[model samples]
Each structure stands twice: as structure tokens, then as C-alpha cells.
Target: MKLEMIGDIHLGMALNRKKADFDFNVKKRYPVISVSNIEEEGYFNNKGFEYFPSTELLSKKYFTEEGEVLMRLTHPNTAVYISKKQEDLLVPSYFVKIKITDKNYLPEYVAWYLNSEETKRELQKVQSGTRVTSTSKKVLETLVIKELSIEKQKRIVDLVELHQKEKTLYEKLIKEKEKQLAAATAEIMAD
Candidate 1:
């Protein structure tokens, strides 16, 4: 039996700009997500656009063990969106961690599927409400998940991780090359 899981449902809340020293309040948290830090490109359905720097920030508080489990479950490159409703309730936006129950599906494989463009479009459609577009647990449960054998799922996960590691190595090499070039330019100028 396969089960689709969705969590982190919350109402959108407006940021209170009038509060003195808003930055001070956010700095108190260990991990925080502010509207300003969220790039416009990543925002879906104008919600991210509507809110600016003054918008309320979301933070996730976790015990050490719970935090480790969450970091392990989610992909390192995946982005997590916070909801305003969760803020009002004093709940962390990352409170809900989703996982599929399919024995064949590896966690990484499922994460990649959810992060794909096609899945995002489907998610947008299921999101309801006018003032603030929100998704419920039911909506996530109905998502169409790919069916694959456990062996295949693990293989895919391994391949994706390998590619990611390669990309990181290449990025480091490029940065080193850039630094060398800069040094050469500076030496030429000095002479």
C-alpha cells in the first residue's frame, strides 16, 4: 500500500511593520525565513510578490533529534515554503514533514518528484482560496505519485546524489579558477 503525506498547513498572515526593531526579533531565532530573503523567482502565485521586506518571518524550532530526522528526509537542494497561518498559531512553517509510504519509493526520489515543474503546476491548481492561496492535507494526499520498484527507486536516489556531488566539485573548481584569474590580473596591474 502506498500513502501520500502532506503537512505544514497554515493560514497566511500579514507582517506587522509597525513593530519596532523587527530585525531584532527575528535575529533571536536560530533559523528564520524572511520575505526579503525569498527570491521573486521562487515564489508561486503572486503570494511571494505581494509580501515585501515588512512581511512576517517564519522560523522552525526543533529538538536536536527531530532536526536531524528532518534534514535527513528532505533534499539538500529542495526549497521549503512557509505559510502565514502557521505563524499566527505560533507553529513553525516546517512543522509538517511529508513522506510517502510506498515501500518502493526512496525519500530522495519522492523529494525530487515533488520539486519538479509538473508537480508544482498540479499543486498550484489544488491550492484554493482568494485572499491567501492555501493547500490542505487532503489536496496533498491526492497527488499522483510515480510507481516504481524499490530497487529502481534506490538506484535513482543514488544517481541523483552522485550528480549533485559532481556539481558541487565542479563549482569549487570554477571558484578556484576565478580566484587565480583575479590574482593574475592584480599582479599585471601592479607591474
Candidate 2:
């Protein structure tokens, strides 16, 4: 099965590259099996957990609601990049949508592939602009993709979902532990 590649098309240029790098570093330090970016993106809006430890369980709150929407909005084979700007400036609103013709690939698998480092570097290579290194819709449409079977695609999606559940359970456990710790400390202080 043939695969197609595409760029992220969205407004706000909301991707924080520095934060992404930091998260990536932390993930490497902890050493998890899943992609750090996916974990980070999922945990972006979550409160309390400043950084995720490798063995530290994840919570549902860490997963970004925006990410779900963004993931669904784009074609499965599309890769999205949040623009990095030098100064505090609002990025122009734009969304690029591409259609994929391949039947063997699932959208979730394709999305993961596009988000990989190797593919990101390739997309960067195609960038022509000086200041922002913008990627055009047409360029994205022509990008190459590796095709995987439907069963494999479903398995990947399942793994991602499983991680999400684990993250949620961890979050719940952590919150409970924090509450218990606080109560115990308060009781001791009262004595």
C-alpha cells in the first residue's frame, strides 16, 4: 500500500518548541517505550504534574483535548507542527487539509508516522522559506508515507489508548496519595 505525507495545518502556531525539547529530555531520562511527544502533547494542559518521570504513571488530564480534535481534524497521514516564532506575535490563522487515497493505512498509524523525528526532519528539509520555514499544502501532499496493515494500525491505536488509560490511573493514584500525605501531615501538626 502507498502512503502519503502532509504537514500540520492550524492556527495560533501554538507549539512550544523549547517546552517540547525539555519534555523530550525528561522522557529520555526516564526512558519509556512510547513517543515522548505524544505523551507530552497529551499532558500539555494537565495541572500538578510539572514533568513526567519514566516510571511515573500518567493521568488523563495530561492529555490535551485540543490534541484529540487536532488529530481527528487532519487526515490520518498528516503531520502537524506548531510554528515557533522568535517574538510574541500571533501567527496567521491557517489550516491545511490533505486527502489520502490509500486503503491499507489507518489514520492513527499514519498520524504517528508523520509525527516521528525522521519524518519531521524530512519535512524540514522541504521547507523553503527563510524566516518561518513554511511548508506548502502541495508539498505536504507529495510527501512519502510507509504503509502498514489495518490490523497493525489498530494495534498501534490500542497501545496509545492503553497508555492514555494508564496515565489516567496514575494521575488518580497520585492525587489520592497527595491527599493522604497532606492529611497525615496536618494530623501530626495538630498533635
Candidate 3:
């Protein structure tokens, strides 16, 4: 199913675009997420987000929930699945949040697809800009996604995670081997 078919997808802070006007209060401030807080590998980076103070007359449904997907609009566009919520965290104007309204499609599944090579290539095609490439909100809605059974989607996520773990272990083993080889060579040279 196309991304649009699953839920309401739109820019996070369409109502407020000016960054200079923001007022952050130390006592009442809320954490805010930006493109840099989202990793290209499709995960959230909790380290770099800033906080914005609570303001009067904020609209409802402004904050993202667990399972909602966020996509960056700037160059090297990337999306992340909201696995957990950082309390009172708000997404700013530079990102679009996709709330999966339908139960048929899994939000995690869609996030995985968005980070895949196929989606990346498609995004690269539509992105325009020299200094900072970007994809428009309208263009974002048009991006396509395949519909897969929940079971299949879960399996895919599992496989990818397994591969990642194995890759880490292999890298560690290689490093250990390299250290051993270096030590052996040093000893032989000394002799």
C-alpha cells in the first residue's frame, strides 16, 4: 500500500516555522526533535535534541506517539520509527511525521521500507537543491510502499536485526585477529 493509504502524513510544525521566535523556558521547556536527531539507519538519536518551552494555545495531537514515523526534509533525507516516546518532545518544522491510522499496515514495516535502498533512490530522484537538497511535503505523500502481511514484516525486521548483530561480532573478531597479527610481527622483528 502507498504511504498515504496507511494514515495522516504531514509536516510536524506547519503552524510555526520561525525558529527565532521560539522561547524556551527552563522550567516548562519540552524536548524538540530535528533532522540530526534521526539517524539515516532509521533509529532515533536521543543525544542531540533541544528543548522548547511550553506555550499557550498549542494545538492537540502535536506530539508524536510510539509507532509514528518521522522523515527528514533536508539533504540526505532519512526517516525513523518512534519506538519510544521522550516525554513532551515536539517535532519542529523541518520534519514530517507520518501517523499510521490504519491497523492493516505496521508503522515499523513502513519505517523499514523508507530506509531501504529502493526508497532512498526514489527520494534522491525527487530531491532538489544545491546546498541542501530537500523533498517537498507534496512529494513525500506520493512516495509508494508495498503492503506486506504483519507476519512477514516482523520476520524481515528480525532478520535485519540478526544480521546487524552478526556483523558487529565479525568486526570485533577481525580487530582481535589484527591485534594478534601485529603483536606476532613485532616479536619476530625484535628477534
Per-model TM-score versus the true fold: 0.53, 0.48, 0.75
Error of 3 at 26 (Å): 8.1
Clashes of each: 2, 6, 1
lDDT by residue (89-170, candidate 2, tens digit) is 2222233322333556555566566666676677777766665456655555565767667898789768866876888899
Candidate 2 regions with alpha-carbon error over 4 angstroms: 1-39, 42-95, 124-139
**Best candidate (score: TM-score):** 3
Where does candidate 3 have its weakest 10-residue lDDT segment? 18-27
If both were scored by TM-score, which would come out higher, candidate 1 or candidate 2?
A: 1
> What is each predicted model's overall lDDT from 0 to 1?
0.44, 0.43, 0.75
Indicate the residue-level lDDT of 64 in model 2: 31
lDDT comparing candidate 1 with the true structure: 0.44
Q: List the residue pairs that clash in candidate 3.
A: 1-147
lDDT for model 3 comes to 0.75
lDDT of 1 by residue, 41-141 (tens): 22212232222232233443321111111111111113233334223222223223443344455555665565567866776777666765655556555
> Residue by residue across 47-100, what tens digits does model 3's lDDT show?
767766554435546677787888888866777777666434577777888988
Point out the higher-scoring one by TM-score: 1 or 3.
3
